[model samples]
Target: MFEWLRVFWQGRIFFLARGDQLPRFLNQALKDGVVLYHTQKSERGMRAQIKLADFRCLRRAARQTHTRVHIVAKYGWPFVAARWWRRKGLLTGFVIIAMALTVLSQLVLSISVSGNRNVISSDVLERAEKLGLKTWAYSKNLDLNQIAKALQEQLPDAAWIGIERNGTDIKIKISEKIRPSIPKEAGNLVASHAGLIKEIMVIQGNPQVHEGETVRAGQVLITQALNPSLPSKTTAPNSAVNNAVARGFVRGRVWYSAEKQILLVEDKVEESGRVATGWGIKFGSRVIMVTTQNSPFEQTNKEVTSPFLQPWRNWSFPVEVIRVNYKELHNVHLERSVVEARQLAEQAARTEVQSKITPMVQIVEENVKVLPSNSGAERVRVEVETYEDLAVYANP
Candidate 1:
């Protein structure tokens, strides 16, 4: 008991000495002034507890005496502390890896865009990136309202865009707007819009435009005049045969445009990042406040959220933590005197022109025409060209 109490902090080790030179090893340990407790003799040799500091001295003595020494047991705080010290680097690395995983789990890792038929998924992803939602972005900092609004502005053809977050994945859903179609009436086929003609498949008519050539709107695409090279192919001046309708479809790159005026100056209140919190309790519309002074900022955007409210048939937790977040706000005046207004107007015009596009139209080119402005805004016209079949008919 006394030896254990004395060596508790310092530590002690029990070792076995085995060899024909056991007596010489013990005598050598004594000569080195090493103390051994619980000494016993066995068939192999001897077993005893030596002070940890003296154990090394005993090992040197045994080596000199040609005896083998094996550790039997270890006890006390020094051994425990030494064992922990040796593995400190491994423990530290484990803690760091755990913390890193926890932080990364709260961020978006994968993004998926779905429910889009006409709009490209990559285009939607690009617009979402502009709205601060992307891979590796902090999921909690994202605002669904802002992302949806940005997508709407960027893709006017999309009727709605929904955003959903699940763990480290963000999924965006889109629904495109359906536009009204034009009523078709049969007559002489003519060019509906100015386009670069790509192909002409005529069953029975004169082809005015060739492949890889530009044509204007209202131009005769498949004229009733069978031989267009002739000065007058019609035998009758005003007969059904002379005014026979064109019979083929003309595929070309047709362009459609829309114009809108953009304001030069924009005014709004912007929110500053600084925020303050206030604690209060709401019991069935009765309020109890812990602090009357909520924020130090002069201008603030205020919001109240109740996290502890009971939703089971309005049954209540009488006391709950009501957090009021006050975000600092500042009045902002913005002017787009440069090309910003023109760019904005062009985006708006593109959105508006989405409704005018016909079926089988594949968009190929997009351009903007900035008209001269003397007023407080700029009038920008955006044109979208598409590859489509222009076979709309007119009176022969």
Candidate 2:
């Protein structure tokens, strides 16, 4: 109604009124050249708003009718209402477009495979497609349980499979199965090396050995016993009694050796380098330059991206980014005297040797040799001796 009045007034006319007298106000406004009328009334009184294009004629008529005393003053639409309509008109199209896009985006465009080890992502996607996952399809239509079962059937190597929908994306999680090794035959596994018994457990065979006993490679810890006291006749032996079995556990010391070379020089040198970029783009091994200028540093590099091509529908696309950086550097030298060089070399060698030995192994001895090299530099060689408590398991 107010919109109609604005059109009628055409930026002309005026009106005023209070509650309980809006009818009378309209009558007065009509006579005074206020062509259109709008009224909002409450307990306080009535509000009659009119356009100003014909205000003079309407005012004159109102005065003649003795309605001037009720006329408050000329005014436009309330500030709150005017601003609301203005904003509504401005944002209506944008709001509609946003809502439509949001609805359209609810489609499960594709199934994305994530956290997969053995199963290929493409295979997972193909299985999802068979399970009703597809482009421009509603996410609610997807049956996650059915999809998971289909994926498992397609990828038997996967031990675990699950499907989920997050927003517009469908995720397929796959876990690969790890094969269990078959246990060796009764006596096939023996102590690989010699060691004193530290622990013992007997599962399937009779334990011939006890804890604290020393054992060697090929030594049996437990033996299968058919009869403990029965004596066999010379003519015939019981087949069951002949089939006694044994099992054992043993830990043995294994020898290992490592060698390291150290170069002694008057000065030790080191070099260091950086790259920054704005937007991301890539093709093959090369990345397109998105930045306006080359990096200020002497070292800079760019790489390209190779994007995957869709077989059927060509909708969504992605790009890869690659980057490499180079540096121009000169070595900064630190001079070391002969005495300092010898100490540093020895310390370095000791650390290197210790890293190669296990914590369980005790260092029995160490030998260090420092000699002048033909290159006019000192050479350091160190040998370390260690011992390990190789323990074995015996069953009783």
Using TM-score as the measure, the top candidate is 1
Writing each residue's lDDT as its tens digit, candidate 2 over 1-396 gives 988566544542333443344566567666555555556655655555454545555555454445532455534445444566789866788789999889877887666777766467877776677777877888776677877866664553454577777777777776554322223323323443455555565544566556667666546555555544565553235344444444333333333333333444545333344344444465545556565335555434443323344334864345554333333343556656767777777787777777655443446667787765655455677777644323222221
Backbone clash count, each prediction separately: 0, 25
- In Å, residue 5's CA in model 1 sits off its true spot by 35
Model 2 lDDT at residue 200: 60
Candidate 2 Cα errors over 4 Å, as ranges? 1-261, 266-270, 273-280, 292-318, 323-328, 332-334, 359-375, 385-396
Residue lDDT tens for model 1, 170-240: 88988664422323323346666678899888866677778998887666666564344433554655344
Off by over 4 Å in 1: 1-267, 291-295, 307-320, 343-362, 385-396
Report the CA-based lDDT of candidate 2 relative to the real structure: 0.54
